[model samples]
Target: MDVLSLIGIILAFVAILGGNYLEGGHVGALLNGPAALIVLGGTLAAAFVQAPMSVFKRALSIISWIFFPPKVDLIGGINRVIGWSMTARKEGLLGLEAVADSEPDPYARKGLQLLVDGAEPEAIRSILEVDLYTQEGRDISAAKVFESMGGYAPTIGIIGAVMGLIHVMGNLADPSMLGSGIAVAFVATIYGVAFANLLLLPIANKLKAVVLRQSRYREMVLEGILSIAEGENPRSIELKLQGFMG
Candidate 1:
């Protein structure tokens, strides 16, 4: 799942770096440790300051989702729901005990439990929807931390550039060193923009995309549970659930 995401990021770096190298730009000039520290380190520090500890932790955790997102098997999910619906119709609530016990996803497990407990469709829908929305809210919050970091990185880079230029100004007595000094001073600006666009902003967007996919899956599961509780036939439930595939 994350293979393509990894390739895209690598390709982006290669395109820019390779192009610069071909044009006689030394890659080592962009390797200023202080510039990276200001842009990336300060961004993380700002994230820690801006978000609650828990939210920040969750944001850190979801960073990997940019590379390896959760798999959503919509077709398989629908087929499972259809099977459950058939069992519920033919063998009644008790028939779902085995399936419910075997279910792995907590949301789906909870739904099956409610079904076997004879929960009214409305009550089941209310509970599951609340859980779904609450989870989505947390995921959104996590994504926002990265978005905020992206906002900070560019400005932080500018600060780094200004500081570098201040040092450069102090060395004006050395004419031979002036050109290198000016180049080093501007690397901070490049660091800030590149980190923000190529990594931070993209990571935030990817995390949001993962959250969106998860939300859709949860909504589909909730719909399936409600359809089953409403005593809809397996064929009808299958038809309704198939819409989630898209």
Candidate 2:
């Protein structure tokens, strides 16, 4: 579980609620269902119009990453690859073929396949680097989709508030309803600002962090594969990769 995400969200809401309580403001006034629907629904509609279906799907899948990030196990995966490379060096390229078959990660599997095929060091590096670039670009694009939504949501909220004010203006004859109408209208703007600042933007930042960390792992893998291909000592390759980490 991503304790930091959970704690951050909890703390943000708690601070708001606590501040309201200390100010003698009733929390019930903030619970306007229609305002929430307008803000959330309008924001999502705008997102759908701007983002691709694949990006939308990826965003949804990654939303849970805000609360429960998947483990990457980077050090362990690199250690395994380094071990295999050492064994292959001691035995032969053919010896690493069996290790590759048992590998789970597609990236590592592809690297091993190239090694088994007797691809040169430069060619192996080129293949892995290309795949790394492609994956990094996709990750960045996915995050940017959410970031764009964060940028759009506040404007949608303002629109909702204006619509609410129009309805309120139409009912000015009932002075008692004026305050509620204005409060509800402004609620849309609040929702928009809160959601954008608290959720969408944060999610984009988290995904960017995840992508950078994953890229680091990919770099380590590239170094290991290239070193193995060039017949460098496994210990030397491990040290070289560790240098990148530190």
Candidate 3:
């Protein structure tokens, strides 16, 4: 679990509530469920229309990343790759067959298998880069689902606000209720903008960052694997791949 993601979200809400409290506002003022329903439901509807069902579903599934981000251990990965390089040097490429079969990451496994099978470095690079980009595309697609929702949410919120205003307009004779009515009407807009800026867009960008790091790690593995296949020194391979660590 990534504490930063979870902590950051909690902190954001805490700040929101804390600020609200300091401003002489009650918590109940922000608890307009109807406003939330309008903003969220309309945002979802808009996102559904913007993307295919599969993409939308996939996007929702990955939302847990906001709390439980997927992690990569670059230092450990480099060590693993260096171990494989050492194995290749000591026992030749065929020695990697067992390790390749045990490799957990499919991309790493495939690249290792190719190296063990004496595939050309150019061919390995081509195939691995394609595979990396393909997975990157899928990750980005998932992120875009949230991006679309974030994009639509504010507009949907405004529409909800307008709808609420129209209702308020219909009841304009009740002067005593005017203040509360206006306040309620604007809740949808608040929900929309807050959700967009605080959660959806941030999560989308986080997913993009995750995908970028994944791509970098995979590319490093590809480079290391190719170097190992070429009988390069393990130290040299480590040096080349370590450039991607940060």
Best by TM-score: 1
Residue pairs clashing, model 3: none
**Any runs in candidate 3 off by more than 4 Å, and if so which?**
176-180
lDDT per residue (tens digit) for residues 47-157 in model 1:
888999899889988888987788977888888888899999999978999999999999999999999999999999999999999999999999999899889988988
Question: Which portions of model 2 miss their true places by more than 4 Å?
Answer: none
Question: Which residue pairs of candidate 2 clash?
Answer: none
The alpha-carbon RMSD values of the candidates against the true structure, listed in the order shown, are 1.6, 1.6, 1.6
Give the lDDT ranking, best first.
Answer: 3, 1, 2
Encode model 3's per-residue lDDT on 5-115: one tens digit a residue: 888889999999999999999899999877888998999888878888877777878788777767788999999999999999899999999999999999899999999
Q: 1 or 2: which has the higher lDDT?
A: 1
TM-score of 1: 0.94
Question: For model 3, what is the alpha-carbon lDDT of residue 177?
Answer: 67
List, residue by residue over 1-246, the lDDT tens digit for candidate 2.
Answer: 888988988898888778889999878877888788888888788888888898778777777766776677777866886897788878898888888898888898899889999999889998999999998887778888789889988988898899889879998999987876788788889888888998789889998888888888888888888888888887887778776656
**Steric clashes per prediction:** 0, 0, 0
Query: Candidate 1 lDDT (Cα, whole model)?
Result: 0.87
